[model samples]
Target: MNATAALHLIQAPVALCLDDEINIDLSATDPDGDELVYELTTPLHGANDIDPTAITPPPFTTIVWETGYSETYPIDSEPLFK
Candidate 1:
């Protein structure tokens, strides 16, 4: 029982216009049906650092577990709200 689970991008953004909400979905399943957590990712930064403890590789971003889907989310911007 050494099955490894993997995520597959099912849907992706395409030809989006300005002020359009972005929607993406990644699906995965564990052979043992264990709990899973998803996170949003950011681009890797300076020195191409990939170290987990480098203090510069950037911490894990937002956890998307149990998040609301099938809804249009407004662009989170300070300028837009002001």
Candidate 2:
């Protein structure tokens, strides 16, 4: 369920390990030739059933990671897509 994480799932170019940390490519393209800028942003998460107010505005909470996981790494490997 938590695919495309970190940089909306694209920020981290490589997977992270617990013992070793590495740099990831946070690069973005505009499709058209244009200047590029980078900035850090927070990830949001909530319940799927609670559809009410899911997109209703500002002051969103950041996502929390569990053990052996960050955002992009340690994803479920079942069913090919999970």
Candidate 3:
């Protein structure tokens, strides 16, 4: 038998206000109960040149998955500017 791993977003952000800080929880499950690591990915064709650690503003990075994965996400919205 082949073991597979998959990730599902339990709770996702639907809407947000300007300059809002919200705490979100992302949960994933595996049938085999295998260890999993979470990482924020972008739509890059096939390039690994951009080192996530050396970024200035700090792009979405990887995180070691635990029981509970919760983080406060900040949303910046400028209605007037747009």
lDDT, candidate 2, 36-62, per-residue tens: 665434357654575855563566677
lDDT of 3 by residue, 7-76 (tens): 5665657897777765566566777887777764333223345764443343555543344332322223
Q: After superposition, how far is residue 61 of candidate 3 from its true place, in Å?
A: 19
| lDDT for model 3 | 0.51
For every model in order, what is the number of clashing pairs? 0, 2, 0
Which regions of candidate 1 deviate over 4 angstroms? 40-43, 46-82
Q: Which pairs of residues have clashing backbones in candidate 2?
A: 4-9, 5-9
TM-score of every model versus the real structure? 0.40, 0.32, 0.38
- Which residues of candidate 2, in runs, are more than 4 Å off? 1-31, 35-42, 72-82
Better of 2 and 3 by TM-score: 3
lDDT of 2: 0.51
| Ranking of all predicted structures according to lDDT, beginning with the best and ending with the worst | 1, 3, 2
